[model samples]
Target: MQKKIFAYIMSVLLITLIISGIFTVQTIEKQHFSNMEEKLVSASYILSQVLSEDIQADNIEHIKAVLSKVSRELNVRITLIDRQGTVLGETSYDPSLMENHLKRPEIQKALKGSVGKEIRFSSTMKLDFMYIAQPIYRDDYIAGVIRLSTPMKEIKGLMKSINGNLLLALIPGLFLSLLLVYRISISITSPIKEIKNAAVDITLGKLDPSINITSRDEIGELAKAIDFMAASLRDKINSIRDKNTRMEAILSSVVNGIIAVDSNENILFINPIAQKMLNIDEGDIAGKHLLQVIRNNKIDNMIKGILENKSFEENEISLNYPTQKIFRLNSNAIKYPESDRIIGIIIIIQDITEIKKLEKMRSDFVANVSHELKTPLTSIKGFVETLKAGAIEDQAAAVRFLNIIEDEADRLNRLISDILSLSELENRKGKTRYEIINTADKIREIISLLQNQAVHKNIDLIVKVEADVRMLHGDPDQFKQMLINLVDNAVKYTPEGGKVQVTAYNTKNEVVIRIKDNGIGIPKEHIPRLFERFYRVDKARSRNVGGTGLGLAIVKHIIMQFQGKIDVVSEVGQGTEFILSIPRET
Candidate 1:
């Protein structure tokens, strides 16, 4: 920039100097030639008057003498010519050797009674000269012509001297001009240099110490503008960083996993939860292709669909790589601002395995409740209709019909009660009234209540509980109910002579109760859903045996409410054992 400015300044000054020198030299030369012509013409006129008498009388010697004396005094060449273009006398050249003077421009004008002047190269003298001629008159008739001539060398010498002086002045003037131009250029460009550096710093994220130009000129205004731009950029950068920080925090804290990929399906960002959901390692996956990282065809294809369509979509997909997990995935195309072109894709994955299971459970619960209620109502309705339509006339038949109706109604009531209890347990939060109780005592009470059923079935019921396992913190009634349901299910399911045993023991952190029954054991397929509401391995046998189908569900819910755990081990024909772990002190 400095070089360019210097070159521009020097070029202008050099051109100005050159043009001024040419114009000055030309004007001075023109003025010099004008004055020289006037002097030559005047000299010619004056000598013509002096030489007129001599030319008329044809006195060559006298004419020659007068012409030579005037030539010496004026330092000009003198020529005398007659009207016939003959050279009469000459001071510098031999008169006989000269060309016909009458045909010369100046001599012809002199013959016409007018002074004429010309500058030409003389072939005879072999030099350049300025010539002036005037006619001499004798008694009003043209006698001869007198011409004055000056060598052009003298004027040329004067012009050369003047041009030399101009060149000398030009050298110093150019040097001074270049220096001034350099100073002015620096003044203009120095502020611009600072602004350029400041702009560079701003790009590099250095937003302090703005360009300092104090001059109240365009450069200073530019500096102020740069300062303003830097300030604005700093604020914008900080705001972006702050917003990014907040966005990261939000993404990190969200329960759903978030992942962003580019149009080419290259992962751009992956939140912490996304890493866990995708079963990816806790390392950087950015810039890696999504298929390479996750290897899930469904997810990759969904992202491709979003990119192609530039729209939003949601799907439920299962990942079987690390584990079997169901996820509800929402994908959206990320676009350039105000444009439809897709730049990337954003996907949110929410783990919905538990939710799906719960949904299935809810559907099954509705179907089972409807079936349970309908069967009993159908039975009661049939029996009541039988008694109403002439069966009442036979007392034994009517009594038997009433008993059948009462049993159906009682089963229906029990089914409805169990359903409502299970629903309350699931929906209610912090509704358990907890109290300290004895684990062994609860088991003994449950056994005593169900002893009659066990006796009727001819099954041996045994209770084994350690003394230290007595104390446990839970809802006393719930714990008692949980024990009764397990024992009753055991007795109800056991064939005659099958043994049912209840055992309670204390561990470091918990009290455990085990109910073992050598009944027709449950199938392996039904073990997973044994605690589900209304899920019976043998539906006909369970209903005929007066099992509500919700007994184990209620027990499971009570244990869960107490933050306890329950596990069941059952074999097809060997036996089944229900183990319950309750926090001893909680």
Candidate 2:
């Protein structure tokens, strides 16, 4: 801006100087020309009056004398012509070569008693001249004339001298203008350079609010304003940093899994809890697909629904890891502003494996314990009521009520005993140490104990084992109890004359024990919840057959404590197969 302003100043100065110089030269030249023409004309008249008297008398001596004197005084040339057009008198030039003056243009005009002026070129003089001739009248009659001539060549010389001086003036004026422009430019540009440096430093993030202040003009004010702006900008940046620091701390400390993604469903950020839960390798998964990195299909599906159909998603999904544990995934989606367009998805994952187990255990315990006790309690109440209503007075009614009460009580006792055994199996910390042993001998021992019951029902109870089954690590007493549960369940569920088989073998990492029985098989929907407490495909039959409803749940907890897995396969009315796969301990 300063450079441009200085350029404008220089331009205005140069134009003004050019216009003034032209007008000055023209005015002086016009005055000089007018004064010179007027002086020459007045002198010619004076010479004509003097010649009028001399020519009327033809006095050659007086004319010659008068012409010479007038020529010397005025610095002009004079000539005289007679009525016959012959050269009568002349102050300069050769007389013999002179033409007849009577018929000449100036002489004829003088003879008519008038003054005439003309510009003409003279060959002898070799220049242009302004010639004026005035008539010498005698009593308003004819007379000879006196003429004055001036060479215009001298005026050309004068103009040339003036132009030379003007040229001299032009060089110095231009030099001075340039010097002025340079010096003033520095005055304006110095402060500008400082401001420019400050702006550069500020933009590059080096300096803040420390630009130079050089003047009291508009430039100085602008510098102050910029400095103030830098200060405000610095403050805002600090505030943002503080806010971000706080947010980061909170995000890190959270226990539940949190992940934030962009509009593309790319993982922008994931908290430590989420990273650990999902088995992610990197702290930052910026460009990876949310599902690809986290390996949760539910996360991908939920985000797709929110982005495509503008719907919300929440569901429980299962996630498994090779070495650590299994997870129950509960995912949720939300639109920040429900009315506005959804920009991205935020997913929260909760480790609900333990919560699910505890919930199932609590609910099952209540239902099982109540049902087990309710049967016996209700039978006793009925007997007491019958006695109160005089049924006790009839011996047959009393005997029947007493028999029902005793049967219900016996069912209650069996339920308690099974519950105790299951509780003991679940409490591995309270159980004895484990050892590697041939569990086939112990399985055979349990088959012998339940063999009479199997024969009474005409069932074929078979025990199959590897010819040289490898020893597996386990607690003998608990192992035998596990065998008892399997054999007992098989005998109770299988029809008369059916085959019940107990098989054992050593798989690479562990020994697998399978119990297959020809019985009513389980349905597909009941397979998953079979290990849950109080869960049974046929509740009335399970209870009528003296099932405590805590057996499978207890078995599940025991297998988990031993770091093992169990599965059941069945088809309704065909048979049931229970496969227990336990890891061989070191």
Candidate 3:
């Protein structure tokens, strides 16, 4: 910028200097030429007066002598020409060797009775000359032409001296102009450079308010404008930053995952949920192609379709890489507010994995419930029908069949009771009665209640509790029910003469209870589904033991309500241990 300004100023100065110099030289040269023409014309008139009588007498010697002396005095050439276009006398050359002077422009003009003047190159002298010609008259008739011509070398020498002076004068002018232009350039570009740097800083997200330019010129005005613009920009940027922060907060807090892409398919933004869902790094995924981050064809194609058609689209896509999850993608084209021109796409992704699992569980639960109820009801109905068909006539047979019917009814009652208990635990929501539960007393009560069954199976039920086993805060009845279910399951699963142990203790934040048993131990793979409703390791053994296959499921629901966790460790041919860690406060 500085260089450009300097060059521009210097160019104008140089042009101005050149024009001034040319005009000055031309004026001086023209004045010199006019003065020279006057001197030649005056000299010619005096010479013509002195040579008029000689030329009328045709005295060539006298005429040539007078012309030579006058030419020597004036440093000019003198010529005499007759009316017949013959050179009669000359000072610089022999009169006979000169070209015809009558046809010369100045001579012709003089013959027509006017003072003639011309500048021409003389062929004989091989120099430029300014000529002034006057016609001499004898008795009111033109006798001859008297001409005076001065060589232009003198004028050229004077002009050369003036041009040399001009060049010498221009040297200081150019140097001074250089200095002035440099100062001007600095004055102009310095502030502009500062503004440019400030603008650069602004682009880099640095807003500096102190751009101090003190000049009062146009450049200063520009600086002021830039300062104003920077201030406005700072405010705008701050506003935008605050808005972006709020937008990010809203997006982050939303349960659904969100992604926004531009028309070019580059990712504009991905919320935290989306980043986690797609297993993408927030820093790495921005401005990246959609497929580069997600690599899900269905979502990418859905977004593309919406972008192309300027319409809303939705799809359920399953991803298996990060985790097996089902996501419902609701996408719509983001368009200009005033028109339907699509600019980008916004996709709201809902993670439906848990919802789908719950749906399937509900369906299976209904089916299992119906099957379980039908099995016992069918058997009871068959036996009653049998008894009604005349089996009552045999008293022993009737007693045996009635006993079977009663047992089946008892089993059906237990199943229904367990089912109702599980449903109640699930539907309890947050309506739980809080009370202190003594872990040791609850275990004792559960053991006494299940004592007969344990003895019948010849199984030893042992309770080992820490003296400081903290009292838990929860619904006391729910706590007792959970303890009973765990203890019963332990006793029911242990083989005859095998051992079942219930341990309760306290941790930093939880009341830990462990039920361990030595029995036909479950396989490692079945532990995950052990708490599922109606899930049995050995169905025949379970039914023979009069188990409803819902005790653990009920225990699971109770533990969930207490905001506790349960884990199982088991190996085939080895013992199984169920560890329940319930928070002490709930």
Candidate 4:
């Protein structure tokens, strides 16, 4: 994150440096050239004025003498051109070989009574030259022009040296500028860190905000802002603490544990439930290694993976023996610019032990019931074929065999129906029809369907529903089927005179459905396994009752399909109650 800001800064600074460098170099060059031009014209003007009279009278030798004097004195070559563009006299060039000069733009301007100059390359001298032209006037009228030409190569060489020095200046200037910017950035950030540390200390200590930084710029203003923010945070944090007392009480009332950590695999905070589970009691264990406190390697690895890579997921891993603590670690990272450093990470740990138990039991029960169902179907098919070969002609034997065959077929049909229902409920990942449903009405329908069976068993099927419940969202058929499965399971387990109650209600966060039975309660040891696909407290009795054993398993899965939570409380030989909580649509 810091690199992003650094790249942006570098780009802006580089552009500014290049633009300013070009402007500065050009300005210096232009001023130096102007000064050199003015000096050349001034010096040549003196020679033109001194030799004006002699030149108009056609004293060519005297013109050459003046030319030589100017040439030697100013390190320049002099040439005198007449009004007709012919060379009258020249200091260095052989007079016999000279050409016309009046046609030149500078020479014409000079003959017109003005100073003229041109910088060009000279073929004879083989160098870049600056020519200064001035008219030699006898009576302030037209006359020949006195022109002095000098190579500007020397000036160009001087400019090159100046450019080298400017370039050198750029290096040192840029270095200092960058250094200043870096120091300013650090100076600005340093106080922010102090304020941050103080705020953190205030939070950990549950005390007042205290920050210290001295400056008198925008950074100083920001330091003041930090001080104000810290004070505000302290007050708000206190307010939160007060409000959280009730929240803490509510969370503590729950049996599940909660653990929240930082990206560094350090235990940053924990709730009461988590504290109880971990058995930690100290002044402050906030910044300690999780592995040092948590011995469970599986959970440690999960937490590390999630915190490092933001891998939020579900898994069943043991936290302690005799008490299995399953957790769903939902985690994410926070990236903040820290001046060329890395971002931060956080992990949230939620105990899903009860939900995990339900899932596992549901799995195991399905497997067992499928085995049971296959066995009977296989036996019936084998027996029917054995009788068909030899007993077909015997009327008495055939009649008895036909009755058994019909009964077995009915059993197979019933088994198939159960399997279909279970599969439909369990396969939540598969597509299914869902719609808005009156959960209360759906409950009544399921109870009515199961009422006759309850009556046959001399069981009282009672229902309590909130009539004022608004319409809800779900697969109504699936919901009804799940309700029938749960109630049927309850009746099957209950004694003849026991009562079964189906209740539905709503809270602020969710709609709840509960099936309670005063029946042969599940043994504490077997309760955890009850929801497994074919898991049974009494395998023999479940088989005798012709149960596929997938009833509760199907119920559990259907509840989950609608994004709900379930829990069962049971006591051996007493009673069992299954509670399902479904979140309300927002």
TM-scores for every predicted model: 0.63, 0.55, 0.71, 0.39
Q: What tens-digit string does per-residue lDDT give for candidate 2 at 423-533?
A: 666564545656765667877888999999999989999999877665657666666666677678888888898999999888888878899999888889988888776
Number of the top lDDT candidate: 1
Q: Write the per-residue lDDT of candidate 1 for residues 1-586, one digit (tens) a residue.
A: 9889988888887888789889989999999999988888888887888777777688889989988998899888898888888888889989998888777898888889998788889876888989899999998988878888989998999999999999898888878888899998998788888888988898888997467788898788888888888888889989999999998898899999999998888998899998998888878789999999898899888887777766686789987768778999988777799998778888899999899878988888788788889998999988888888899999999888888888998998888888888888888866778788877777788899899988998999999998777487768888888888988888888889999999999888888899999988888888888887887889888989988679998998999888989999988677889999888874
Better of 3 and 4 by TM-score: 3
Candidate 1: clashing pairs of residues: none
lDDT of 3 by residue, 186-224 (tens): 988888888888778878877765688978988778778
Per-candidate Cα lDDT values, in order, are 0.86, 0.76, 0.86, 0.75
lDDT of 4 by residue, 449-478 (tens): 999999999999999998865556778877
TM-score for predicted model 4 compared with the true structure: 0.39
RMSD of 1: 7.8
CA error at residue 116 for candidate 1, angstroms? 5.2
Q: Which ten residues in a row have the lowest lDDT in candidate 3?
A: 305-314
Candidate 4 residues lying further than 4 Å off, grouped into runs, are 1-370, 389-404, 414-427, 430-432, 584-586
Model 4 poorest 10 in a row by lDDT: 340-349
Clashes of each: 0, 3, 0, 15
